[model samples]
Target: MSAPERIPPRGVTTDEPLAGLLTHGELTVRGRIREASNAALYCTVAHEGREAACVYKPVAGERPLWDFPDGNLARREVAAYEVSEATGWGLVPPTVLREGPYGEGMVQLWIEVTTEGDTAELLALVDGEEPEPGWKAIGFADVGDDRTALLVHADDERLRRLAVLDAVINNADRKGGHLLPTAEGRLYGIDHGVTFNTENKLRTLLWGWAGEPLTPEALEVLKGLQDALGAEGALAGRLSALITGAELDATRARVAVLLETGRHPEPSGEWPAIPWPPV
Candidate 1:
């Protein structure tokens, strides 16, 4: 099939309007984003004379994971967005699941963030090495061939909040590339299909705050999440539709642990602490 028409990111403000379109819009595949491991189509969605840019990940296109159940990655992606919204952190862009050209799939509003030059340089800094004043070094790793690479994350408050969000979601695949930076300096996290596992698979590149005390602001957010997940609440109900009961329970457990510990988690070392090809 031919790709859908391309629509630039302009006047795409507010989630409700975009979300309504994703839920009930006409989606056309614009092009295939070749960088993704699974099939991901870039498309323009139109509804009621309005148009927006979005990425579509059809369920049939998903590569099965041994640990995760089949045919549900799309739903998990939406669940991550729900958690982000509930916490009011806005770490995730607006996303939703609906029938598309390729059957049921995930449709999320595309975020146009920094993808070259200065942004790349900031993320590639060596670990333990100070970042240009405002930035902070989180962790470092050996990138083979006797070379060591640092895993530095932005020290901005928004990025730090996202680190906590990843921990709660059990995100097993938070590569550096998943962190998107907007023109206005806001950071957004994307590609959350591998999240919400019952296991302790919180692997990511945002360990800069490891073992450090959780800021008051972070603790408050955690508390809010806990409340939102209470029995009969909308957030809890939404999550139930996407992940298993055990996985949902485990997510709450993780939040409780974080609340009790009041600090960033250290790597368990049982599994790979960081994702391969980090950036």
Candidate 2:
């Protein structure tokens, strides 16, 4: 897709105005998905003739509310995707970000794909244990012609380049379970709540190619991203909306470092080697 003329609504971070999804009245506790975090509720709803799986993250509150909490995560994720969009890396599209009664929320296009649900299955697959039919491997390490690739896999080098984009973004949640395999062999990445950390949380299995050279095209894309996202321009302004000043600063520093080095940073000097919730 060509660069979008407008940045997504979710790209903004203020909570004063919420996206008028659901209703003005208090959000009722819709039936929940069995596998989402307690802090969030996953439900299916009808939106414009399509079934949507939306995560309702209530603001940090005393009573349970059906809204987004910590609007920053959604904002940062949207901005991250906005920056990534210029590079044409299709790992994760910048879906909609909106505000809700309790907190800020996001709406994203869902891809139908088969997933195994955890890193152990991924490890087993790497170890030769086969999954049920139709569940193909698509992650960071799964691409390219190297055996020591990181724990993830995708069908081709394009996805691998997107994986590199994700790495530079410091995506803390690059778990095997989060990688989705579509029937077309394209891998769709998900769950970016813990990115843009200032502390350099690089915990990911995609680091299998840490020391390898980035493809020329990938390098050009990164440069493009750096150019579009000025040192203190759109990206910085956008990230400041979703993350703490410190976290945003850290993310910018990390991006700057990646642009300068053209490689993922090693988690040295007391920085954590992995991120929490590796899945």
Candidate 3:
């Protein structure tokens, strides 16, 4: 375990370069992200003078979840990445499911967050009747000692795309901390191991645009996703190796519903709408 190698950061929007690097680069572990429920290792990937920091979550360190009975959270993480790439949103970092030091795992480029722009403070809890302009209300949250506060998230386009993506993947845990804002003013969402469930487990704090009409950009993206998720499409083929058939079908269904309704999703009364510790 030593200091991570530093190299010029690659633009997240230019994903192909980073994807190739993560897919074929040499990996070296630096440390473990102990806060992660699973075995998430902080590492570096380097190839031909191009070096970048990244994270490696090996399958051997996976912790079983009663609901996610498949026991392959690593694959789901990669599956989420594939779906994100299809949307052309790049909400996810460049991630590849490859062999690593311990075993096969999801390797993703590390995101460096800088407080250099407006995208910095996207989520907040306010003591007001409603969220101020440029912010959207998620719901009321219990503060403490019989107190309540209005929880809200920024009304940024990046977050709007993420909300749609979360609905598509049935993300079960989209906590506030999972949103990574870069100095480039770009946003990325991580920790998708519990996503793509066959059920409506879309839990997150980004429910600000619930029931609103889907943006035209999002509609176009969904159209692309619909085509790519078909029986013999490329996206389907890529996801087949990462997720189960039922889950894939569920993903298709979600897209169809979005296209049909032309709106954002609302919470299903069956599951918790917001995750615990909302942030």
| Better-scoring candidate (lDDT), 1 or 2 | 1
State in Å the error of residue 97, model 3. Answer: 0.5
For model 1 the local lDDT of residue 120 reads: 64
Which one wins by TM-score: 2 or 3? 3
The candidate with the higher lDDT, 1 or 3, is 3
- Model 2 global lDDT (CA atoms, 0 to 1): 0.52
Q: Indicate which candidate wins on TM-score.
A: 3
lDDT of 2 by residue, 45-162 (tens): 3432223344554434223323223345555556555556556656663345555545656544445554433324334335344323423332323435655333333334644665
Which residue pairs in model 3 clash with each other?
none
- Give the worst 10-residue stretch by lDDT in candidate 1: 4-13
Q: Clash number for every model? A: 4, 11, 0
| Residue range 1-279, candidate 1, lDDT tens digits | 444444455223355666787789898899999999998999988887667788999998999999987338899999999999888878888889899988999998887865532356346666455555666675666778997766576676876888899999999988888887776666778999998888899888877788899999889999999998988778999998888888889889999999999998988989988887787
**How close is every model to the real structure, measured as TM-score?**
0.90, 0.64, 0.94
Error of 3 at 178 (Å): 0.4
Question: Candidate 3 at 65: error in angstroms?
Answer: 0.8
TM-score of model number 2: 0.64
**What's the lDDT for residue 192 in model 2?**
70
Which ranking of candidates, highest lDDT first? 3, 1, 2
